[model samples]
Target: MAEHGWLFWALTSAVFAALTAIFAKVGLQGIDSDFATFIRTLVIVAALALFLSYSGKWQNPATLSVKNWGFLVLSGLATGASWLAYFKALQLGDASKVAPVDKFSLVLVALMAVIFLKERPSAQEWLGIVFVASGVLLLALRR
Candidate 1:
């Protein structure tokens, strides 16, 4: 378990992400997706702030390097945008369909890592990506 700690965390992330789609879809009813995203972001910030302060880890954030800030800000923006689109899609589509399409980003991430991060995926990883891509396409096709 210690050696595969990351795998455990990744699996936990997938479970929570699946729950997120179901919960968000239900919550989006009678609410604007953008407003819902804003509310969710506020909740996340509050939770993180409370955890950081409780753990006495809330050091001066100003000490972070400019490069760190730049990347973090960009990442936050990307997250917000992704959430917005996901919420909107969930509002308009079935969770079963929307979730697979959204998760197709996993395949995109693998390709982007190879091209931009110069990280080469093993053949098995590539095969898994292909399977995910195929599943996404099948899920997306009109019945």
Candidate 2:
């Protein structure tokens, strides 16, 4: 079960991601994208805080090393940028088209992992990336 944990979480992530696109698209209909992103972020922060507080896993901030803080801060910044862009895209484009294009990040992540993390993906993984790329194009192309 532990070995398949990531697969389970990835599947869960995909489901929630679909819901995110749908909800954000509808919520963004009349609001500024940046403000929408801000509201979403606040809700996420509150939810996580509540979860951590209930779980008793809210660690002391001073326990983190500088390296850990640096990476987490960078990750947070990237997430914020991605959310802002995604919300703006949803505001301007069809959710169906924008979401598939956004998911091209999946292919990019595989490549980036190879380059930056030196992780070797199997041939099957590469094939899956190819299919994902193809699907994105199919979904996003106007003609």
* Regions more than 4 Å wrong, model 2: none
lDDT of 2: 0.96
Poorest stretch of ten by lDDT in candidate 1: 53-62
Candidate 1 segments whose C-alpha is farther than 4 A from its true place: none
lDDT of 1 at 75: 92
Q: Give the best candidate by lDDT.
A: 2
Model 2, C-alpha of 132: deviation from truth (Å):
0.7
CA lDDT of every candidate: 0.95, 0.96
Tens digits of lDDT, candidate 1, 22-63: 999999999999999999999999999999989998878789
lDDT of 2 at 133: 99
Candidate 1, pairs of clashing residues: none
lDDT of each residue in 1-143, candidate 2, tens digit only: 99999999999999999999999999998889999999999999999999999999899999999999999999999999999999999999999999999999999999999999999999999999999999999999976
Task: For model 2, give the 10-residue run with minimal summed lDDT.
Answer: 134-143
Error of 2 at 134 (Å): 1.1
